[model samples]
Target: MEVVQTIAELRARIKTYRRNNDQTVGFVPTMGFLHDGHASLLQKARSQSGLVVLSIFVNPLQFGPGEDFERYPRNEEQDLAVAEAAGVDIVFMPSVDEMYPTPTRTTVSVSEVTTRLCGASRPGHFDGVATVVSKLFHMVQPDQAFFGLKDAQQVAVIEQMVQDLNLPVEIVPCPTLREKDGLAMSSRNVYLSVEERQQALVLSQSLQQAKTFIDNNVSGSFTSEELQRLVSKHIQTAPLAVIDYVEVLSYPTLEPFEHSHSITTLIVALAVKFGKTRLIDNLILQVRK
Candidate 1:
């Protein structure tokens, strides 16, 4: 696999691939720390497109003050090896200075979907996500972009931005990858101590309970708030886990919780802090009667 740091070279390479209409291009956007979850996205992209492009840039815009931007994991050698092994054709690793030479006043923001859950917890988080994704989409100009469902809200935000702007690309949502013990895979998992890692299981456990409840109540037996409380209560049982937010929202709309409505799908998600490490996990329940 080839690694290119400058945008001009990356754009030129993609431009060459684009010239051939018969050959479709696929893109996967990610930060540097490579993991199985990221590998899964690259593999999916490889299977769907003739050529795949993976980008590794820990977008500064996405991190809020006091966040882990400065210290978020970074191992380019390992990340590149993982991407190459997953069949990535080209890897775009750009420097922060190269991406944003001068902090200008342009931003790409989406509404409603960015108001709750992770968005609500981290102010301006989704704005950073939407803006960077928009910039990447414009620069790479791929036929399709693959994303994991691990960040359901992030996926939703990007989809909205693409449709609203009429961007010429397809956003493909892939399933979330997890550990053998059911903990959702994340780069931050490295930050967890052995004891805290065990406590982290509370996240997946709570989500699984919510999923089971929803499965049994396909006829719409529970209110949104009721289901949320059930999940929150379960997570709170773990002494080391501090509940960030446990939410149940309408599928794609991510509508605010209120009275129950018979719907086809519901997104159950949560964020919990295991000491200094914060982990997020989500499940999508499709009502089947």
Candidate 2:
């Protein structure tokens, strides 16, 4: 339950904790506006490490010029309560001024994998994500870090970044937490109007439909283009669900499948606009006999 604002203070606190040989640190880096999905990450981090550190900073670098950077949710007091309840040992809630004292000229960018799905639409979004995540990894210096699979591509990107940079921390991926209706839990869920929210169920429902297709052997012969059309058709049926991208690709590599390979796992990932709020969800299927 200690809140450390500056990096120097955080380093000192971590130094004190490291002096004890038995302690292992776990870090969860997030933008504020806490939700159960974020809580799941914190709980996982708490369970795995001797001390859990949660950092809440809505990084401005990650947002494109027209994105919701200015309007992104923030409830510091509530976030602190949620983190404390989830057994976070240290809450590193740094201000933008503290994180970027001057303008940042250097940026961390990942290639190939950054050009698809959410990346294709948002433009420079993953670069911002990669840069900030690298900064957090440096700032926290934890043995293990937790991330939710809700952003599956993000998890893949961070894994690649860690491998490329040889960062000492392990990137732990947690499953996406969903609502009773199957919509993935996100802070942006608040932006959905009641009507838009209801229509949003199509995102997950279509994934379920795709899963059913796979489960029943109907998807075995479905080409990637056909699969994308199938999911897109279902999503568009709901007037409120505007398709951003519906793609089927190799699981972790995220390369599009030229043909449905028997040995490769398929990722059915999609992003849809429910009114103005963009929601994303995916289904991972192993092609097996």
Report the error of model 1 at residue 282, Å. 0.7
Ten contiguous residues minimizing lDDT sum, candidate 2 = 217-226
lDDT of each: 0.89, 0.89
Number of colliding residue pairs in model 2: 0
Question: In model 2, what lDDT does residue 285 have?
Answer: 86
Write model 1 residue lDDT over 1-289, tens digit each, in one string: 8899989999999888778757889999999698999999999999999889999999999999988898899999899889979999999999998799899489999998988999999999999999999889888988999999999999999999999999999999999999999999999999999999988888888889887887677576678888888999988888999888888988988986465566668888888888777789999887564
RMSD of 2: 1.3
Q: Pairing residues by index, what is the TM-score of model 1?
A: 0.96
